[model samples]
Target chain A: MTFPESNLRRKKLGQALMFGLARAISYGIVAILLLILFFIVKQGIGVVNWRFLTAMPENGMTQGGIFPAIVGTLYLVAGSMLFAFPVGVMAGIYVNEYAKEGPVKRFVKMMTNNLAGVPSIIFGLFGMALFVNELNFGASILAGSLTLGLLALPIVIRTTEEALKSVDDTFRQASYALGGSKLYTVRKVVLPIALPNILTGLILAVGRVSGETAPILFTVAAYFLPKLPGSVFDQCMALPYHLYVISTSGTQIEASRPMAYGTAFVLVVIVLIVNILATLLRNYFGKKVKMN
Target chain B: MRLRRFTEPVFESLIKISGYSTGFIVLLIVIFLFKEGISFFNLSPVDEGSSLWVHNSNPVKKLTAPQIKDIFDQKITNWKALGGNDQPISLCTLDELGEAFTEEQLGAKFERLPACIDSYIDSLPGTIGFFPDKQTANALKNAQPVQVDKVSFSKFISGTEWFPTSRPAASMGVMPLLLGTLLVSFFAILFALPLGLAAAVYLAEIADERVRRILKPVIELLAGIPSVVYGFFGLVVIVPLVQSTFNLPVGETALAGSIVLAIMALPTIITVSEDALRTTPRAMKEASLALGASQWQTIRKVVVPYAASGITAAAILGIGRAIGETMAALMVTGNSAIMPRSLLQPVRTIPATIAAELGEAPFGGLHFKALFALGCILFIITLIINFLVERVSAKRVR
Candidate 1:
């Protein structure tokens, strides 16, 4: 089809308009989201003073500084990574290296996608019924860890799978030609290449769990937590839940509402810091491998 | 040969195991939700002596087992039996917005109510129906709420306080709570959907690749944000903005909830619809322009039509986000279970109902079961919409 002279100008204008809609909407959304983050960080970071974090929330303003929550969130993140990463990464390896386009492999892919979409509150309910109450752990850190672990499993799998998908086939071919087994090639070559991407995914997942309040609301996170968690079985406070209480149900310290912002600011900083650290590690290792 | 015999079988079997296990775990979540959620349908004889149902305990220690039974059974149908000579006791239920109604007001069907047969027996105590044990549920029994002299039970159901667990006759029901959830979600959807759609429509129809990349990630990060932080922003900023703007008595009105939910759902709508528009074929835009259509005209017509199904999916997804969101809604919505019709009024939604109260609810208790039942309802609705969205979006060639 031949285009008329008028058509070209009109089409270009139409394209710009179309593109502008996306541009404007995206910019607006970004601006608001940034505002949200900026607000939280501005209000919250001041309260996350080193002493406040190290010590408990005092004089009602503190909301019991998120020291225990930081530790609890860390513990939960570590525990979840420990629980899910190996299984998720291994599953990715199996899916990429071994499983052909068979029904079993297909089913695994479907499961991974569905797992990603299940709203986390459902996870909370399931955890409450099965892990916390049924497993008789009560509202302990262990239950929270396991539930959060399950939440992250889908992320780990999907990201690791994508990373593996991007790996070149020549590496596998060379490894096999050298009489290396599939396992040896994957362990040595495929995994190392995909490590950065996989780690990035894991970090993102941890960031998500660290900030979530719903799953642990019923599974863990007690309000009015008098003493700190001495063990894994005891219920502990979390920054997210603490923020919820301070904002929603706080009968005390209505004036110290900024503490919630302080908590959020710290949360965002922690996420950004982890992301930066992960990026550095990835970059450092990436450079090292290239040099080698 | 030895390696083949052991390694081949062992390694292959292990791969098979993990692949199958992941599928099983996903299935396990669905199965778990359906199983617990479905258990609510197995209604048994509340009339007692029926072996089909197990005898559950009355969780409220303030009332004895018999009292709990009498109250739920509504054997005492009027206030006169409880030392007041007036007012009829009605079977009441708090809707998600904590809107309550007695049988007389609701007017309608079910298994025969117990106290109704006794004919408003004056000797019998006034009893309220519906499960009330969890902190969010209303105190129908021994709920000594402000005694209104109204002849009907609907007036009492509309009152403010909603303590499900309280001393005799002094009680609080979640009328304000139900209202709070609805008001918040309503306001949230009001703010979120239009703004989200406008942005999504814009991004999908017009943005350059470089701008799209930066903007898309920023929006996605909005999705990645933990909601507790949103709650903080709402409490600190949005609350003040609303109070100052409206000059209303309370800052934590439905308007705050709308603002928060609107922000949260923005990314989903934009991402989905933008992807939809992006995938619209270059050929279509070319054809539209050949007709001398303005770029704006071409977009308003051809490009948008191409992405219509995707836009619908985005809207549904936004709606899902709005409906299912709990923490932000709960935190900002003032948690008052009152009946509110206006967007400015405080209201609560079903998800908030479960989140705000499920913690204190004992397993197998009436309140617990009711919340679980609500979960089931939410799951079914969301799952159906999700399924439809997935189906249509998948067919979208982009």
Candidate 2:
């Protein structure tokens, strides 16, 4: 073969090999994911019955169900959302709408980034010291929720900012031309357009709150609470905490294996559902924006 | 319009307060961690016991922290090492201090007290007693109260053992834990970087649009999975797999933790590097290809070089995730606080140590403070990583 021809063939072979390797590596992710999902489902499905979902645990947590854990997780998610949503939304608006280019804005942005990077366990420690001990909230859902709220706060702000930014400036200009005040334009025009994306953030937050074990572990997770929590002040069992307990610390580790799997499966499903909802909302809103 | 006039200032202030609250929260967390953690340096575990007591005849006036540890660990088998009479040392339990009280004073409620106390200081000339602080006033009449030397800040940081709950001499050294965290994370990076880079390259430069579209969400779902679930999988799957494969008695080795962490770090590494690779200029890529370079050559020589800073940022973020991960590591990495030399050996990371023990550590105790110190270390490490990522990504912008 001539020099150029040989070089072309060699180049084609190299590209083919690289492309084939890349494609194989990409599929490897799918395979590993499927393996995890399949393993969890196969082990957990046997114990994921109605009793497992709705009844309180019994027999040193080797029998019965994880009802209180489910309730506690829901309560934590709700409490965190209550604290996080408005604050996060407002912060997003301030960054994207009110603040232009200032040191304060820059500081806030930097703090948000740092806050996102702060380890979740650090958040737990902080919560235990501040909310649980100093403030005398004790180990309760309120403290756990507040810690988790802080954790989810950065995600909320980022998502809300992105959502609000994606709204056309023309919409704000139009509202202003119609004599709308800044607050009026934001409340009536910008937020409405940003609602779907904001919901996406909130959904993502739900997914985050449900899955978090570290932040809640010290702040609220009760090792064995058979009854549902009566108030925010009451310590409660949570699904993630329950799974941690059964798998590692339970009295009857061998007996509780199925229960542990069931709890994990439930927690995974809750997070997955929230994530799927958020993804779908994001895509739909994205498509709508593109079409517009 | 009429309502807006009244609400505008109120709304604006609210927005400002909420916006700046992130700064407030960060300040509060840092302050709280430092306030709680720093106190451990001067904390005396002797405060927990009724009072510190040595034989009235012993020459040793006070014992330092290491001396106390040595006595408890039985390393100082004789009193001469502690500047006392050259005699065999006897470790006394809290129950042994009850002999100081009378039968009527200990009646019913204190019935078992005298015998308990007798067994503690029984015939042993070099007995060291750690009584509860509640018994301090009563115990001084019978036995001398020796002041517990404060655990110096340096020992806490540099010491190797981490038995925070060890009685009489709770070793709160974080060296093993710090080492374990670094070792596990280093292995995690070793495992994750190549796979993540390969996958990122595929998603960015190799895969068709259709494949990219499908794989992206699948990766997101993996990222979205709750870490506790990952922990469960590690416990049941990786831990046993490691055990059987390595033929170790227990599965919860550092290797199991590293594997789990590698998987956890993959999404961050892949996503960040892919984003970086996508930002490589199309002009540069085309120029490389037009110069008779293969697609592989173009990607390697042009795209990767262009995205180097971004890839570095990705690797930093990935390492950050791996180091900070708590649950999975806690579950799978045997919570043994020993200086680890092998991947098969059980090791404890800083975050896992905190997660496993923090709940039981009393609020104002040395253990609690030590855990907080670990948090401070973790926080600083992550902050440095974040700063590096920021600097690297900032260069990408330029």
Query: Candidate 2 docking category?
Result: high
Candidate 1 C-alpha lDDT tens digits along A263-287? 7777778767665665676678767
Model 2 agreement with the true structure over B294-329: per-residue lDDT tens digits: 889999999999999999999999999988999999
lDDT of 2 by residue, A1-292 (tens): 3567778898899889988888887798778987898888888888899988888888999889999898898999999999999999999999999997989788889899999999899999999999998999999989999999999999999999999998999999999999888988999999989999999999998898899999999899998875778998999988898999889984599999989989888887886788789888888887886776
DockQ of each: 0.43, 0.80
Candidate 1 structure quality by residue, lDDT tens digits, B297-383: 777889888888888888777777777777887777776555666666666666777888787765765456546655665666566
User: At residue B298, what lDDT does model 1 achieve?
Assistant: 77
Candidate 1 error regions (>4 Å): A1-25, A60-64, A224-228, A274-292, B1-12, B41-190, B197-210, B283-291, B337-340
